[model samples]
Target: MKKGIDWRYRISNKEAMMGVVLAILNFIWWYAFAYGLGSRPVKDYTYILGFPAWFFYSCILGFIVFTILVWIMVKYFFTEVPFDVDEYKKEETE
Candidate 1:
C-alpha cells in the first residue's frame, strides 16, 4: 500500500516558504536603504539621532520592521503542528 503526503509536511513547507519570502523582502528593504541613500557623498549625507540616514533606516529601522513582520507572520500565518510520533500514528490510522 502507498501512503500519501502528510499534512504536517504541507504546513511545514508553507511556513518555510513564507519565511523565505520574508527574508527576501528584508533583503530588499536593507538593500534599498543601504544603497539608495548611502551612495551619496559623505558631505551630502543626512543624520538621524546622530546616525547616518542610510544606517538609521537600513539597520535600525529595518530591525524593528522585520521584527514586527516576523511576529505578525508567526501569530497569524504559522500553524501549531504536533511533532509527537504518536500523534502522527493516530492520524495515519484514522
Candidate 2:
C-alpha cells in the first residue's frame, strides 16, 4: 500500500547523520581503548571488575557506551512516523 509520496519520509538527514557519527564514535572509542590502554605495560596496568584495564574499558565499557549512544541517537535523532500513516498508503484499485 505504499504511495508515491511516501518516499519523501523514507530517510531523513538527521537519521543518516546519526548513523555515520555513531559509527565513527564507536570506532574511535574501541580503537582508543584497545590501542591506547593496550599499549601500556601490562605489569603496571590495573584491574577493573576482575578484568584487565584494557579489556574492561575496550569490551565491557565499550559495550555499555555503544548501547547508550545508540539509544540516545535513536531517541533524539530519528523521527517518529505520524499515526496517520494510512494517508500515505494508496489504493491500488484507484
Shift in Å, residue 11, candidate 2: 4.2
Task: Please identify model 2 stretches exceeding 4 Å from their true place.
Answer: 1-11, 82-86, 89-94
- The C-alpha stretches of model 1 lying farther than 4 A from their native spots are none
Model 2 alpha-carbon miss at residue 41, Å: 2.8
Candidate number of the best lDDT: 1
Q: How high a TM-score does candidate 1 get?
A: 0.92
- How much is the lDDT of residue 60 in candidate 2? 91
Alpha carbon deviation, residue 56, candidate 1 (Å): 0.5
Give the CA lDDT, 0 to 100, for residue 78 in model 1.
96
Task: Estimate, for each residue in 1-94, the C-alpha lDDT of model 2 and write its tens digit.
Answer: 2656455455665577779888898889888988888898889788998898888998899999899988987887677654455654543235
Write down the worst ten-residue block by lDDT for model 1. Answer: 1-10
Among all windows of ten consecutive residues in candidate 2, which has the lowest summed lDDT?
A: 85-94
